[model samples]
Structure formats: C-alpha cells, structure tokens
Target: MDIILTSLINLIVFVLGAAIGSFLNVVIYRIPAGLSLLYPPSRCPHCLTRLSPFENFPVFGWLWLRGRCKHCQAPISIRYPLVEAATGLLFLVVLWNTANPVEMIGYWALLSWLVALAFIDLDTLTLPNSLTQSGLVVGLGFQIARGWDNGLNPATVSHALMGGIIGAVLGLWLLDIIAFVGSIALGQTAMGAGDSKLAALMGAWLGWKYLLLAGFIACFLGAFVGGGAIALGWLQRRQPMPFGPFLALAAGLTALWGETILNAYFNLFFPTW
Candidate 1:
C-alpha cells in the first residue's frame, strides 16, 4: 500500500515538474533575449506562428510535432524535450529525498534556478543576476521562516541563519577572488561572476559546511573534463568552459546527500571528532 501511494505521489510530482519545465523553456529563451516572460504567448521562433493547444503539450508536444515548427517546419531544438525530461527527473529525485513540504519547495526552487543558470551559462556564458541574487535573498528568508514555523527559539535561529548567510557569501566571494587572481596570473579568464553566483547560491542553500564538498566536487569534475577536452583536441588550451553546470550538479547532490556523505567521511576519518 505504501509503495503504491509513494509511486503515485512521485508520478504526480514528475508531471508537475514537466509542466514547470515547459515554462522554464520560455524563461531560458526570453530572459536572455530581454523579452517579457508575460505577454506575447509562446510562438514559433522561425514563423512567429502561435502554437495550438494540442501542439503545446510539454515533452510529448515536441515528439508529436516531430521536432519541427508546425507552421514553418523549422526544426525545433532537441533541448526542449531534454529540458522537460531533465526537470521531471530532478523533481522526482527531490521528492524522493525530501519529506518536508517546506524543504521540498525550497529544493525545487533551487533546482529550477540551477537549471536556468546552467543552460544560460552554457549558451551565453552568462548567469543573470535576477535568478542568483533573488535566490540568495529568498532562500535565506525561507530558512529563517522555516525555523520560526517550527517554533524554534528566536535568538538561536536568528543567529544561526545570519551566520549561514554570512559564511556562504564570504565563501563564494573568496572563491570568486581566487578564480579572478588565478585568471590574471595565468593570463586567461578561467572563471567569471556567473560561476561565483552559482557557488553563492549553493552555499546559501546548503550551508557553509556543505559548501566545501560542493566546491570540491565541482572543481574535480571541471578539472577532469578540462583535461579530457584538452587531450581530445575538443578544446584549446586556456579556452573557457562553462562552470555553472558542474557547480549546479554538485549543489543538487549536496542538497540531497550532503549529510550522508559528510557523515560517512567523518565516520571513516574523524571518528573521534
């Protein structure tokens, strides 16, 4: 009985995520283009033809449309369906890992923000301030509110939350400066403000303790990929690569499994502490 109920809940969450993913497509396109997210409904980029209701179905719509604009037959980017599916999977994962309603919502918001930043950075090499800055302020606010809602002591919760905010901001700022100095020292732009914002959001949401884990994982993956690309001739030496995706991946993993990983590490190495 419990299994069935859980499966049903996960399915519902996936569907909701798919729906939100559809909207995120609009955000990914319009936000970077400086277009209004509202007004002027989704239309074909090539023909400017407004899509019909049936043709607008999330992932299935792209499949049914045969990856082409219905009016002009211009090929649709495969990324549309990919984004929808990815968001659905993220929602499923978050739901599976989180039991608290408040935490679930917060995790979803973080996931959505990361998805936008990842794609935007991939395409344009930029992460807009709107999502990152808003995420920092809003996410920390929720942490405090969650503490209050749980009937925690005001003074303790306030101090803890304030410390988390300060620690996270400082950690990310330090990372930004290190990356900046490294770029200057190497005579190549190795990282940018977008990556810094990504780290900031991760630190804010996951707290200072988990920030190190996220940063380490991101750096490891980034380095491995950078080396591979350099070896394969896919990238030139000193060429820039988007780091937001690695950081985002690390953030999602940390959000879901930070405690487990941290506990395992401590049990193995720092048992006495």
Candidate 2:
C-alpha cells in the first residue's frame, strides 16, 4: 500500500511539473522577443492562431496534434513537448533526492529557472536579468526564512545572509575575471554579463563551496562539448557558443549532489584521511 501510494504521489508531481513546464515554454519564447508572457496566451507562431485548451495540454497535447497546428497545419517545434517532458523528469529526480518539503519547492523553482534560462540562451545567447535577479532574491530569502525557522540567534541569521551574499558575489567576481582574461586573449567578448548574473544566482542557492564545484563542472562540460562540436565540423574553432546551458546544467547537478561528489573526490584521493 505504501509503495502504491508513493507511486501515485510521484505521478501527480510529474504532472504538476509538466504543467509548469508548459508555462515555461511561453516564457522562453516570449521573454526574449519582448512580448508580454500573460497577455496574448499561447498561440501558433506560424499562423497566429490561439491554441485551444485541449491543444495546450502540455506533452500529450503536442503528441495528439501530431506536432502540427490544427488550424494552419504548420509543423510545431518538438522542443515544446521535449521541455515539458524534461521538466517532469527533473521534478521526479528532485523528489527522489530530498524529502524536505521546503528544499523540494526551492529546488523545483531553481530547476525551472535553469531550464528556461538554458533554452533562452541557446536561442538568443542572452539570459534575461529579470529571471536572474528574481532567482537571487528568492534564493536568499529562502535561506533567511529557513534559518529563522531553525532559531532566532544572531549568528544563525548572519551565517545565512553571509552564505548567500558571499556565494553570489564570489561567483560573479570569478566569472568576470575569467571573462576579462579570455576577452584579452581572444580579442573578443568571451562571456556575457548574463552568464555572471546566472552564476551569482546559482551561488546564492548553493553557497560558495558548491558554487566553485559548479563552475568547474560547467567549464569541464563546456570544453568537452565545444571541442567535440568543433572537431565534428559542426562549429568553427572560433565560434562563440552560449555558456548559460553548461552553467545551468552544472548548477542543477551541484544543487542536487555537490556534497556527495565532493566527498567522493576527497575519499578517492585521500582515503587515509
């Protein structure tokens, strides 16, 4: 009975996540284009036909429509459904990783932002300040609330504020330094300001130590993927790729398993300790 109940709950959570992801798609498409997210509602870009309620039902809706607009028969991008499904799976993973309700809600919000930022960067090579700044505020606020709930000690409040602020500032500083150096070497912009803001937001949530780990992971993955693409003739050696996706991926991993990964690294190299 417990197993069955747990399965049912998981299913419900995944559906909830998918519904949220459907909204994220609107944000991803509209925000970069300077459109109001809530005004016009979801519509077919090709035909400007407003999507019907049944036709806007997240993953299943796309599948049911055969990935095309009913009114104009224009093919819809598969990315919409893909984003929805990925968000659903991501939520389930977060559910498995933590039992704390507060943590789960926080992580859910973080991942949602990450997903939207990643796709937006991929499309436009820019991360919106609105999302990044809002994320930072939310993260720090969450830390303060959680700390206060634990106790009313001054030390506790100071630690929470310091952790969030220092982590965010450190992330921004390090990225800016890297960008400056890389720009000098390349004679072009190496990283966008948006990337730094994204990192700062990440740091606010993960703290300074985990933020460092996330940065390392982002760099490593970015290098590997970028190199592979260049080698395969998909990109030129000098081509600029958006770094936001890699950063988002790294942040998500760190948020979920930074401690486990760090411990494993130390354990492997310093087993005697």
Q: For candidate 1, write residues 99-139 as lDDT tens digits.
A: 88888888898898888888988888888888788878776
Per-prediction TM-score: 0.93, 0.96
User: How close to the true structure is residue 33 of candidate 1, measured as C-alpha lDDT?
Assistant: 93
* Model 1 vs. true fold: TM: 0.93
* Candidate of highest TM-score: 2
Tens digit per residue, CA lDDT, model 2, 49-79? 9999999998999999999999999999999
Cα RMSD for predicted model 2: 1.2
The per-prediction tally of clashing pairs is 0, 0
**Pick by lDDT: which candidate is best?**
2
